[model samples]
Target: MRPLADRLAALLGPLAVVAAVSFVSSLGIGVMLPLMPLYAISLGASPVQLGLMTSAFSLMNTGGQLLAGVYMDRYGSLPFIRVGTALYAAGNALIATARDAVSLIAYRGFAGLGAGGNLIGSRVYIAQVAPPERMAMVNGVLASAASAGQVIGPAFGGTVVELFDLRAPFVIVAVTSGLAFFGLLTLPVPKRPAAATQRIGAPTSALNRSVVTLLVANLFLTSGFGGFITTYAPFATELRAWTMLEVGLIFSLIGAGSVVLGTPLGHLADRTGRRRVGVVSTIPVAFFGLAMVLDWPRPVLYVITFIAGGGLTAFTASWFALLNEASPEGRKGRTFGFVSALSNLGTVAGAMGASAVWQLFGLPFGLVLPSLSALLAGLTLLALAPGRP
Candidate 1:
């Protein structure tokens, strides 16, 4: 057999293509995400409308993944990826023309469909291509690349908004995503590789119990994360009196932390149990959430947010690896899709829940909501002992 180096070398071309696609697509999304609240606010969106806008995106993303997962299992990822990129580009472009809160919310939801397709397809492609021993590390690298995009995109979007206009970021996102869609055309079509024989239907028993446990764990954790992220920009603006540039920098720090830590954590997860790492990471995540509730100086806010970002990033990398390891062989696509759908469902619930609470009480309670939920997930996962089976 060829040496492992040679084998990996052969896979490099395809890996590069996938990574590029992931980076560019995520770049487009990152550009929009931090600025989304500002854009909606410009359109006169209330906190409730803001919550609904984010919820709409998550809802559509969840639905899209459910559909894409099935089609990917039946057919392949390349076509879905291409179509998804096109739609993503279109959605971003259309959002630039949105003149009202309702139109912006609708456009964002439409964009989520494309985003979901791209996310699921890229991950499934990675699962299919990487060897089991290296899967987590590869996934981590992909996550890191996505993080890198987040780092750059937000800063760029912030600068654009500060320099030019609120609408400029949407236009830039559209142009870049269009370029990324063209980039997709140059890549060779990917085929789903064969794996261990899989039973067709789900009886709950069809999958490893650990897999189910991990899924449940993700549901709660993702909800908390979603709530935190959705509230992040808005709270910074209204409560802390931050500029758009400052908000972008805070988000950039989060992405920067993730990019710095993702690969090493992935490597560690591959060696130790992913569940163990994920469980440990959530502790700091919850603590930071609580910490953020405290009124701090702007610089202190950056430091705390940075550390919280690292914890959350570590948790997600390990969690994703665990999901990959726990999935049955032949159904990687659908299995991941299920997780994606569930995770987004949690996101919608968390964001809406937090927004409601924020509307009622204040920023502190809104901030506490997600962190407390994460604590609950961590405790539950510990009780479940996810590594046992």
Candidate 2:
């Protein structure tokens, strides 16, 4: 018999081309993420302006994902994926030349559209190909690949900035995106599931209680996350007295944890129950947020942050697995789209709101809000999500 590693390799071999493309693209995005807040500040943005930049990205990201969801079923995922990737690359290139915050924000908005399209396209493709019982496991493999890029990207971003300049990283990102685009060209067009054909006459999925509740929960969940990412870099640098290198390393740590833990956790969720795992996964993230506010020691913060990544991966694996399974045949795109829309909207709100709180109240309250959002998200999930026991 083939060894487990061999078996798993064979399973993923067919997906390697697409997965490689995703990794390259993700790496490019990862390289820019850690530096983004600082870059905005360099462009003379105020804290609120930084929030606006992030919100701009999230706004278009939400719209693009929602639009892609509406059309992916009819037009297919490949087109959106291809175009989105190209646009994202272009956005990075534009950012490299950005002379001011206004231009940067506008460019980010453009990039957000690409983010949305690529996100939904890849998700639908994954759902169609995943074996029913192995949804989380399959997603785990993908997450691991993406996180590997993220692990490398931030670390690389820091080194490149020190070695050259901030513009250099953005330039590198543009080049990598082109590589991903070429890789994507090798893909065969995706076909909808045979099951979807069989259900051709079935009605579109309605926004029932379970679906609506799930969306709301996701919205709350993403909002906290959105707020944190936008605010964190600045806080780390100005208040925490952490160097940019330290911040970069921290992001790398998160990514590294995701790469290390994503697959194992997914398998665990599959066996233990996706919903149960998802519910449990929320605890670490909520704690991580609150811990940050309370000024946990740096070493402890690192440990919690790493654990938070694992929790997030577990939650994501389970959540997507559940979403895909519960979706009506022929409407998976729309279902995922709706969830993305809500989630990204939450991101926009979180980023904006967090910025507002930090500007007005202080950093402690800035941290407090996200913690509350995350806690509420889990509570909503526990009470109302499908498979509640």
Candidate 3:
């Protein structure tokens, strides 16, 4: 136990730095991300245009992840982390100057590149440093850090807007991202080890049975998430007549649940069974959307959203723990990049498609998309993927 304690302590040293970086970075991004729709709307963006903006951002994010993945093993993740965060900060600065929806789309896409770079780099770094035994917990901690920032961001964004203007939050995003960039620059990353197993050359593909199954599940899951997020603020604001502050708080509820429950759920997955926990996780999150069909009171809505957030965190911890374990030695970067690219494509589809759906059919239909996607995700997980305890 003493030896185990010492090992975890050693692991936490690096993880702690990353958590801090993620938290600071996510705080700014979170404040801005959900506001994009409202921003576009304020710029007279139609629903179709709004969908395009989201798709473009996600598509660029996919491209950046693929690009970073190809070189991460050779160069290590530290450079990507610093560079990506820098680009992201620059992109947010650009966002503050957008005069039209078209410009917003272009600027957002550029920012997506930074987001991709930061995400893939962070995951690869975590994979390298965390032991298989602790992957879930480590991931949970990192996610919680990010989520913690998000929990504060939405409400803060609303407050910032009330205090200043809509443009104010993007400036905050740029500033915070800069802080994260400088923070990550200070980490003492070790040199990259030689890619021993990668002598096989960068395969044209990273697909295999386990990987394919897992990626498919992830695609379905993220598709649901993309669909839900794309329509979230508009639905709450337009249909329910909620204020930006209320909407932000609702969004924060999701993040708050993740911050509070992420580590414990990951620990649960580690203890019970990854597959079981992952499948069960879909329940609350999926239902949270469905519950919106009712005209529930505010408190009820908050509770539901919070539980959904916990389920979302649980799914993330369990599924990614499996993914981290499945990555091949010397190829973690490429595999993660590959998975992220494809899964994010699902996000693109969800965002674009759901936008059109809500525009044509009405908002209630939008809620159904995520629930369906969650069902598909659970089915895929149940059918394939490793069920290691």
Per-model TM against the reference: 0.81, 0.82, 0.84
Q: What alpha-carbon RMSD in Å does predicted model 2 have with respect to the real structure?
A: 4.1
Angstrom error at residue 199, model 2? 9.0
Stronger candidate by lDDT (1 vs 2): 2
Model 1 regions lying over 4 Å from their true place: 1-3, 34-55, 97-106, 161-166, 186-191, 195-208, 229-249, 293-304, 352-366, 379-389
Most TM-score-accurate candidate: 3
Worst 10 residues of 2 by lDDT: 196-205
Which rank order by TM-score, best down to worst? Answer: 3, 2, 1
Clashes of 3: 0
- The CA lDDT at 353 in model 1 is 93
Clashes of each: 0, 0, 0
Against the reference, the lDDT scores of all candidates come to 0.75, 0.78, 0.81
Expressed as tens digits, the lDDT of each residue in 11-89 for candidate 1 is 6776776777678777877787778999899999999999899888878878778888878877777777777777877
The alpha-carbon RMSD values of the candidates against the true structure, listed in the order shown, are: 4.1, 4.1, 4.0
Q: In model 2, which runs have C-alpha deviations exceeding 4 angstroms?
A: 1-11, 34-53, 97-106, 162-165, 195-206, 230-249, 293-299, 352-362, 384-389
TM-score winner, 1 or 3:
3
